[model samples]
Target: MHLLAFNGSPRLRGNTWTLLNQLKRGAEEAGATTEEVILNKQHIKPCQACESCKKTLVCRIKDDMAPLYGSILSADMIVIGTPVYFWSMSAQMKAFVDRWYALDLDPIRPRLAGKRFGLVVCYADSATETASGVVYAFKSAAAYFDMRFYEPLLVTAGDRNDAAGNPQALQAAFALGQEIAKP
Candidate 1:
């Protein structure tokens, strides 16, 4: 199986990234090949909302997001990791997610119908408000695209590497990875 992970946090070494790595290790152990895309570092522009793509059957923007369509189609599962900023996901994550609108219209969308998607969210707050919006949005998007949604792994971490010390969080991430990778 092929699993593609997107690190949606701008901080490369933060808790979001930490959990993603742990999750990736579990998937690797389960015999899945994986690839990671650091969304913050990619030059993906926000969706223009132009109707042209609907006719063209592809995103017309000639930016970094051009090649990701193939990656999404090739992967059996897709994992997105992000830090809760304000009451929702980071801007980088939002931008990447927004660009997925065209994927909904792609001619190859049917071939990717069952692509599994999971979210890994790290937040500083104990309250649900910190990450619930992100959870709902990703879930809703998966539904719209007909992708199977895995249980999200939400970690309440206040520090950069808190996920490393939180055994429960790490274990959940690892299990999530394995769950998606296994037949």
Candidate 2:
């Protein structure tokens, strides 16, 4: 099986990236062919609200997100990792998630249905508030697409690489990865 993970953290080697890699490592150990995409490094434009995807059944903007369509469609599971921003997921993650609108078209919905999903969110303060928004977003999307929602990992006070010091969060992320990899 193939598992795709999107690291939406702007920091290349911070807490979010650290947890993302840990989770991916567990997925790899679980025998899944996994790939992690660092969203900040890619040039993915925000949705323009042009709604051109309705008739064409594809995003009109040409960028890195185009290639991701195929990977997202074919993957058995997906993991989203991001640092909290404004008590929610990072702006980068929001854009990427919103772009999934292309796949949510009525005719194309099947491409995303029944897949599994996991969330990894890190924050500096009030983990509850930061994680709640992100968790709700993912859960709503999973429900809309009939996908399985795996347990989420929230790292509190992890503005830097504080999450790496939290053994519990690391183990939880790894376990979630293993769980989603199971048939």
**Local distance difference test values of all predictions, in order:** 0.88, 0.85
Model 2: runs farther than 4 Å from truth? none
lDDT of 1: 0.88
Expressed as tens digits, the lDDT of each residue in 1-183 for candidate 1 is 999999988887889888998899889989999888999899999998996778988888989999998898889999999999887888988888898878777576686678889899999898766789999999998888899999899889988978889999999999999988887
Give one digit per residue, the lDDT tens place, for model 2 in 1-183.
888999988887888878877887788889988888999988888999898999899999999999999999999998989888887888888889889989889888977888998888888875376589889989999989988888788888555768778888888788877888875
List residue ranges in candidate 1 displaced over 4 A. Answer: none
Worst 10 residues of 1 by lDDT: 103-112
Candidate 1's TM-score reads 0.96
Q: On a 0 to 100 scale, what is the lDDT of residue 72 in model 2?
A: 91
Backbone clash pairs for candidate 2 read none
